[model samples]
Target: MPYSRRAAVYDVEYTEERDVGFILGLVGQAAPSVLEVPCGAGRLSLRIAPYAGRLTVVDLEPEMVARTVAALEREGHGGRIRGRVADMRELRLEERFDLALIPREALQLLPPEEGRQALAAAAAHVAPGGRLAVDLATFLPVPGGAPDPDYYDPARTDGVWATDWIRTLSDGSQLVRQSAQHHDGMSIRFDLQYRVLQGGRVAEDWAAGMRLHRYSRGWIDDARPDGMAVEAVHGDYDGSDFTGDSPRLIALYRRGPAAGR
Candidate 1:
């Protein structure tokens, strides 16, 4: 998901949740210098600026980076933020940060190999004794059977709630469409689709499929790169201990004594 094409609708489609603030607080407590990879639309960056001594954010999409810069300028934090367009797997910076964050399950978007590469790249930029934090979702069974239209209307802006929800299959892929109208004459719509392939053919298809890689504490701890250690894993933004039943996995890692420049 390049996400650049949908940059305009991204912010509205996915509103900030409580977890964002939780992550921001954790980052603020960990360090004053922060590095945020895949900082989409500057949503979290804006919140991080006031508490951070210096903030550096990067995204693979130029449009997203531009939006972040624009947002920073609008919020008067442009002077303190350094926004760049770069791939996390290939990131190379002369400076190190006291804290590095890959929030919003951005790591889950990549395949396992690419995800590892990105993690290593992120860890490389962490200053010794510093920290790296990543947010990921644990694998859960698809809502048990058929999708319910009413379940999709989790957000509403006025008297009108989301409706006309439908799911369809096309060329071995499934597509889901839903829309809602706001009181300000504006409307929000989402079209999500994905397919699972096997032997060059589609084996399964699902609507609203996130195509995310499910992560666990064991997996993260096992995948830690040299010079970095998994420090803690939380089930939520409130610093709860991660468990098999936890809905979210927020993993924090600390750089080893010999790590980074």
Candidate 2:
């Protein structure tokens, strides 16, 4: 799918609307010279603006970056927060941040190789003793974990009407909507269309595939940097310690003073 197309529904559908206090209390222990990667519409960045010493935000989608920039300007924080159109895997910045964050499973959006590149770029962006934090949704990567076929009612209580069953590919790497609402235990298939709008006009139509990968605990350990120290692995942004069944893995990495010298 086009990044802009996805960005249109980003704020409403894809965003994880967790409280700022929840994330701030954990990150605030360290000063907030923070860089937020894939900061869609600058939601979290704006939320933590008061505490932030310096905020550098980046998003791959131009529309998202533009919206965030405009919002910051309207909030009179344009000078305090910098919004850029950049990819996390190839981030380039003049100054290093005291802390960096990849929120709402933004890291998982990338394939494994690109995720590695993102980690390398993040390592370069943080100063020695600086921290890097990643927040993800905890979900078991079981078969048919993708969104089921359903209709989204803009004005409704449930908001979205998900289908009863979703078809799974043999390789477990792909999922496609087969049918619409069906009776309990009765399977159905469906094909749906989505439209992206700009200025209230249809701009594009996105057709792509999506799959979920519940990152194993081993995945976090493998991502550890050569010179960086693993500060903490938490279950969530609330700073609870990680356990074997912890769904979310918030890995805090710190580059040691000696190795980077």
Candidate 3:
């Protein structure tokens, strides 16, 4: 995702609609020090700034970090916000946090192995009795899978959530073609395109493409790494108990004292 353009308009595009009130309420109850990975625009950080004892906001893009820093400065909370540009898989924070968050399915952007690595990294940062929270987007299979929207109704979904994409690549022996999406409101107008290549030659062209992941309870059960223990899983931000078919996977994992070297 080329985010330079998005970085400029990110706040207007999403900050207001981020549901910080709900997140803050959760943070208040948890009262956990936080390290928010991929903390885009620092919207959540700023919202939870006063409540958290310490916060370290990180993003892969420098511009995003700059934008978040600017927002923090504008809000007079620059002293409380520590902004950095770091890869989720290669996290390098020295201090342990009571809570480490990877919200908005930021984990989905990584390959499965990287996701596991991040889980380990996050676990390494959790102090004894600390918790780790992350969201999974049950919306679609990631990396190389198409979205299936038969379960969703655009008119009733309530929000400007939608997606569409196309990809075409034909090699002499291998052919790859896919078009998938779920569009709503103004999303219908946005489309992504890709170039098709075959045997290193131009074969054709293609065009292409979460709510909290709608992972099942079993999925969460399976996500437990070796050193973490599952505390509770929520279906949504409201703290509903996770069901097997829940549309969102809100998970909290605690790092056992045995974890970490």
Per-model root-mean-square deviation over C-alphas:
11.8, 9.7, 11.2
1-261: candidate 3 lDDT, tens digit per residue = 455645554454343433465567667766557888888877677777888877888888898899888877887877777888888888888888878888756776554556777777776777787788877645532233222232233343343333422223122332233323344422322233333456666554444342212334565566676678989887656677766544456788887888542
Position 225, candidate 3: lDDT: 65
Runs of candidate 2 with Cα error greater than 4 angstroms are 141-209
Where's the lowest-lDDT run of ten residues in candidate 3? 164-173
Ranking according to TM-score, highest score first: 1, 2, 3
Question: What lDDT tens digits, residue by residue, belong to model 1 across residues 89-204?
Answer: 99998879999999867887776678889999998898988999988765332244222122233244534534343333334433333443322212223345434444456665
Model 2 TM-score (2 dp):
0.72
Q: In candidate 2, which residue pairs get closer than 3 Å at backbone N, Cα or C atoms, i.e. clash? A: 149-163, 178-189, 178-190, 179-189, 179-190
- The list of candidate 1 runs beyond 4 A from truth reads 1-3, 139-210
TM-score of 1: 0.73
lDDT, candidates in the order shown:
0.70, 0.63, 0.63
Q: Rank the candidates by lDDT, best first.
A: 1, 2, 3
The prediction achieving the highest lDDT against the true structure is: 1
Positional deviation of residue 18's Cα in model 1 after best superposition, in angstroms: 1.9
